[model samples]
Target: MSLAARTLELLRDEGVDRVFGNPGTTELPLLRELATTTDPSYVLALQEFSAVSAADGYARGTGRPAFVSVHAVPGVSNALIGMNNARRSRTPLVITAGQQDQRFLRDAPMLGGDLVGLAAPACLTAEEVHTGADLLPLLRRAFARVRRQPSGPAFLSIPMNLLAADEDVPVPSRIPAPDAGPSPAVEEAAAVLRSAERPAILAGDRVGATRSVAELTALAEALGATVYPQPQYEYVNADSEHPLTAPSPHFTGTEIAKALAGHDVLLVAGAAIRPHVWTPERPIPDGVRVVQLDDDPAEIGRSYDVEVGLAGSVGATLAALTALLPGREADRERGARIAETLLRERTTWRDRARAGVDAGGPLDPASAAQAVADAVAPGTVVVEEAPTTGPALRRALVQRDAGDYHNSSGNGGLGWGAGAAVGLALAHPDRPVVGFLGDGSAMFGVQGLWTAARLGAPVTYVVVDNGGYRAVSDALPPGFEGTRLGGVDWAGLARSLGLHGTAVEHGSEIGPTLAAAQRSGEPSLVVVRIRGGAS
Candidate 1:
């Protein structure tokens, strides 16, 4: 069989049903083979960045590794930004780039460069298949590395001549991921939690990735502990409305220290102990014990000092800890007090949002977000990258499901949401997928709209057109300049890209526009023009 045929067979055996890519001359051999194969459908993007971002979202939505193919050096370089985003998000991806024919190596042909070197930094593993015989082995290794615990993107460079050559290569069987059993440190961590007067659980995106929300919730309730998400990677660890579940505190060190002031024990589960994007120089409260749990040993106590660091599966460790700890009834009083505080905070935020809605003139972000949240059907998936309006949207929408929300702020990467929505919509075809993007972010990967339209993806792209990079503007010191982004008609651009486009200037139009777009059963964009100033 040809190497391309064997590659497809191996991918199919590994449960890859689709391949996302933007093809070039070197990829023609693989593309020809893919056209004849029916199992793994080819989903094309106009650009390599969109291709990688789409795969990233698909992996996140499905809890499975995704495959992507691209042209050689330039293509891999173009996709590096998305690859970095995937690395930060810990999304598993198998990225393959087609290299120039091996025979032209001495000449260093056009479009021929060092593909492996370009992709290595952005991936967990990067290698090249030097011969047809090496292709299957390299692919097997790539798949294994990408699916390991603390999984990330892997890259493989396949020469075009090798892919086209006939070879009697044996199809490699898929390798199962290794699991780490419970360790003694788990018991020590449980002991710390049980003995502390006030314990708190800090969950992260890994909790959702591991499907360990139920176990984490059980452990938290067992200790009568308050649950907070890592500030940058907030999602539903417990039910969002649960009394013990609190919104993630601010990212600053001072704010986090304040929130954790009284907690005697901090059980950091399925997350790094201290992964801060930007933090003030404030120490955590003295005498506060930190116990960390993670599947990756490298991340245990990586950022902050820890009393107990356990390396094992998050779900299994939480289950064991819950079994060892006392029931929620044991600390009912402490739990009640924590619950009351969280309830008051939530109430205050909601009241403030209601006032904003009632006093609206030009559409405020909070009001616009609330309208969309109210209009979308239950179980709708939101892919958000609206940095300036994130807090407002989080307060207004208040997503409760563990899988209903995905944000691109993990790596602070713009332009991810547009393409991610395309892949997420494909992953969950039955549910509506909304891409809430800032106007500045929308411009970064606007080409993805063409792919959405081509695939007829069910996405309602809401471009929050604030006329500038509001997040950057808001962060700058008093009178800094050069952030203004004026005179771009996002709705018109969407229309030109073959999507249904609507321009909305008032909060009243947000709901109707979103509803109509969803009902249209095709790719659509709503350009929401807000009061244009620094956030």
Candidate 2:
């Protein structure tokens, strides 16, 4: 078999059913093989950014490493932003870019830049394939590394000459995942939680990535502890509707300190407390005993000192802790009180959102988000990118499943949500997929709409057209120049890209329009106009 054929077979063996990419000259060989094969299909994107972001979403959806093949140097460069997002979220992905033939190295070919060096910053490992013999080994290593606990993106640069070569490489075995057993330190960690008057659990992206939210919920219930998902979490780490799942405070050291103030013991599971902005006060307050559980040991005690570090898989460790610390009457009573407080706070938020709807000029961010929450059906998958409206959206939308919600890695990258929405729709065809995007963020990856149209992916994009980059503009000093944006018709843009499109100028129209768009079962966009600046 040709090297390209063998590579496809290996990917199939490793559970990658589709390859997302925008092909070029160097990628033709693999593209040809993909054309001939039926098992592992190719999903083309208009740009490398869309391709990588699509793969990132697919990986998060399937709980497996996704495969992507892009053009050599420029393609790798185009893909870097999405790769950075993937790396930050620790999403498992195997990204390959085709390089120029080996014989042209001395000639300084157009696309002959060093792929490994360019991709290294965003990948766990990046290597160039020298010959056909080196192909399978490198591919195997990439798959293995990405599937291991604390999984992440890996990059491989394969030359066109090697891919076209008819060298008979050995059939590769399925890659093995590293053991995800709980650590022996779970006993000590449980002891700390059990002794504390108030225990708190912090869930992070890995909890959702590993499909361990159930275990997280179970452990929280067992200890009767309040659960808070990490700030800027890439996935739904806990069910939003769960009583123990409290809203995360504002992203600042002072707010985090205030929220976590009463907890005597904090279980840092698959998350490190991260604040969006720095402040003088520590995020984790003093005298709070910390018990950290993580598959990646490097994360344990990385920020604050920990009383016990449980290095293991999040699900296994949480399950072990739950087994060790059974529920008690006092714990149950405390949990009930916490649940009551959370319920009251949520009711107030809903009331505020309703008020926005009633007394509206342009829609408030909270009211617009509430409309989306009301429109989406149960089991719908929501992808978040509206930085201005996101907090309101989170509070309003209900996520009952681990994979029901996803968002950008919060690594300062903007174009991910548009393409990710397409990929997510493709991944979960049975479930509705909705993308809540800022008008500014949508423009960054707006080309993704064409791919969604071409593939017939059922996705509803809710663009909160607030006219500008409100999230950034809100932070800037008054009278700052060059940030304001307006005048583009988002619905017209979506229609031009071959999807059904509509605009909602009034607050009351938001929910009905979104509901209609989602029910269409075709890629569509609803541009909901709202007041601009500072949300």
Candidate 3:
């Protein structure tokens, strides 16, 4: 069998039924082979950035390693931004790039740069396959690493000549999943939780990635602890409507320290202690003791000092801690107090949001987000990239279920939402997918709309067209120039790209417009125009 055929067979064995890519000349051999294969379908993207972002979304949605293929040097370089996003999001992906024929290496042939070197910084494992015999083995290793703990993208550069060559290689029967049992530290962690007067759990993306929401809830209930998600990636960590759940505070260390001031013990699980984009002058609160549990030891105390760092599977560790803790019945009074506090905080936030919505004129981001949230179906998946209006959206549209919400990683890339929504719709064909994007963010990878329309994906794109980079304008000091973007007809652009388009200038039209797009059951876009002056 050809090396390409063997590689496809291994992918099939690993249950990868789709490949996302934008092919170039060096990728012809593999593309040709994929054209004839029936089991694993090929999903074509117009650009390499969309290709990688699509795979990232698919992996995050399905809890499996996604497969992606791209051309040589330029393709790898174009894919770096999305790959870095995947690494920061900890999405499992196996990204393979085609390299030029090995025979012409000394000649410095076209598209013959160091693919591994280019990919190494963004990948968990980066290597080049030199021969047909090495292809399957390298793929196996890549798949294994991508699916391992603290999962991220892996890279394999296969030369075009190698793919065209015929060599027999042994395909492994099965690759075992990584598992870490309970450790002794789990008991110590439980003791701290049991002794604390007020305890809190700061959850992260890994909790949802591992499908441990129930375990986390059980642990939280046992300890009568309040639960908060990591600030930047606030989705699927816990049920938003749960009595013990609290909205994730701002990412600034000083803000977080203030939010968590009253809590005596902070148990961080499946997330870093602190991931901040901008530094603050004030330090974290000094009184609280932090205990961290993660599958990756490197993440335990990387950001802040911790009292105890437990390295193990988050699900297993939580299960062990729950078993060691006393019954929830013993903490009934504490649970009641926590519930009352959470309700008060939630009420205050909602009142403030309502006031903001009422103060704005005809079209406002908060009102539009509420309308979209109301229009979407029960099982709809939401991908968000509207940074300036994201807080209002989150506050108005509460997500109660796991795997229902997705956002950009800590890297905060602009074009991630459109491509991710496309990939998500492809992954979950039975459910509707909606992308809430800023006008500036949508322009980053607008070509993804073409792919969605071509595939007839069940996706509704809602662009909050507040002119241009509103987030930038809001962040910079007054009198700062260069952030203004004049009117752009995003709906007309979508219509030209073969998607049904609707434009709305009033809050009342937002829900009906979205409802119409959802009823059409085709790729559609709703352009919502709002005031673009200060955030």
| lDDT (CA) per prediction | 0.83, 0.86, 0.82
Sort by lDDT, best first: what order? Answer: 2, 1, 3
Question: Any runs in candidate 2 off by more than 4 Å, and if so which?
Answer: none
Summed over model 2, clashes come to 0
Candidate 3 residue-wise lDDT, 128-168, digit = tens = 99878788888998888877877889999999999988777
State candidate 3's TM-score: 0.95
Once model 1 is optimally superposed onto the true structure by TM-score, how far is the C-alpha of residue 323 displaced, in angstroms?
1.3
Of the candidates numbered 2 and 3, which has the greater lDDT value? 2
Which is superior by TM-score, 2 or 3?
2
Separately for all candidates shown, the number of backbone clashes (residues 3 or more apart, or on different chains) is 0, 0, 0
Name the candidate that leads on lDDT.
2
**Candidate 1 C-alpha lDDT tens digits along 1-535:** 8889988999988889989999899988889999997789999999999999899889887878999999988899889989988887788999999999999977999989899999999889999889899999889988988888778899999989999998899997888878667756777887788888889888877787777888888887888899987765634555677778887766667777887888899988876434344556443567889998888888886777889998888888899998998785658778888889988987787666555654455567777677777778778898888777766777667566778888866576678888999988988988999988888888988888999999999999998877777767877864555787868988889999999989976677777779889888889999877765453
| Model 3, global lDDT | 0.82
Span of ten consecutive residues with least summed lDDT in model 2: 477-486
Instruction: For model 1, give the 10-residue run with minimal summed lDDT.
Output: 272-281
Pairs of residues clashing in candidate 2: none
Instruction: Give me the runs in candidate 1 sitting further than 4 Å from their true place.
Output: 273-283, 328-330, 358-360, 477-481, 532-535
